[model samples]
Target: MPKLKVIAFDGTEFDLEAESGSTVMENAIKNAVPGIEAECGGACACATCHVYVDPAWSEKVGQPDVMEEDMLDFAYETKPNSRLSCQIKMSDELDGLIVRVPEQQA
Candidate 1:
């Protein structure tokens, strides 16, 4: 399993063990990490699971797809590193993935 680190809006941190193939949003929701509403589950249809990929891991995490990009338009305070957590699947390459949940969901 890959390791996941989720930081909440108030700076609380959740260190989790993420199963391979599971999404960052899934891990956050499963672990009850606040700030990741994931209202539409992992369908890529909503921006409620918005997170900021740590800058050091941004390139590895990659950019969102067209559908996700479209939904992200509804997220609050998006940045170059902003991503819909539900779209980020875990893998060996993402063993130490780190993400920060937003203060508010879309």
Candidate 2:
């Protein structure tokens, strides 16, 4: 399993062991990470699962798909590094990934 580290702007953080097939959002929701509401339950509808990937991990995770990209536009704080967590599938390569929840999401 890969390790995931999700941090919030307020200094709250959750680390969980994740499997390759699970989505980042799933891990967060399962662990009760505050920022990811996942209101749409992994569907690419709600932008409530918005997250900001650390710039260092940006290239490793890549960009959100068209649907996710569109949803991200509605997120609280838009940025080049912003991504909908539902779109990020965990993998060995992404172990130790660090994403930050926005202040609002915190």
Candidate 3:
């Protein structure tokens, strides 16, 4: 399992042990982390699961794909580091991944 840290808008931090191959959004939802809505499940159809990938992990986590980049147009306050949580699959290389929830979803 990989460890994940989700920082909420109100400053809540959710530390989770995530299963490999599952998504960051999945862990957040399963752990009841306060901020990931995952409205479209893991379909990559909505921006409700938006988050900011921590600067430290940005290079490894990488950028969103073309389809995801389009969907991010609807996310609130997107930045250079913005990513749809549902698109971030877990793996040992990504252990200790950190992300911050936006103030609100799209």
Task: Sort by TM-score, best first.
Answer: 1, 3, 2
Q: State each model's CA lDDT, in order.
A: 0.94, 0.87, 0.94
Q: How well does candidate 3 match the true structure in TM-score terms?
A: 0.98
Worst 10 residues of 3 by lDDT: 33-42
Q: Against the correct fold, how does model 1 do in TM-score?
A: 0.98
Error of 2 at 81 (Å): 0.3
| Model 2 lDDT per residue over 1-106, tens place | 9999999667887989999989989999899888688888988888888888999999999987888888887888788999988899999999999998887641
- What lDDT score is found at residue 45 in candidate 3? 96
Identify the runs in model 2 with alpha carbons over 4 angstroms from their true place: none
Residue-wise C-alpha lDDT for candidate 1, range 2-82, written one tens digit per residue: 899999999999999999999999999999998889899889988999999999999999999899999999999999999
Task: Measure candidate 2: CA RMSD.
Answer: 1.5
Better of 1 and 3 by lDDT: 3
Q: Per-candidate TM vs. native?
A: 0.98, 0.94, 0.98
- List, residue by residue over 9-84, the lDDT tens digit for candidate 3: 9999999999999999999999888778988998999999999999999999999999999999999999999999
For model 1, state the Cα shift of residue 41 in Å: 1.1
Worst 10-residue lDDT window for candidate 1 reads 34-43
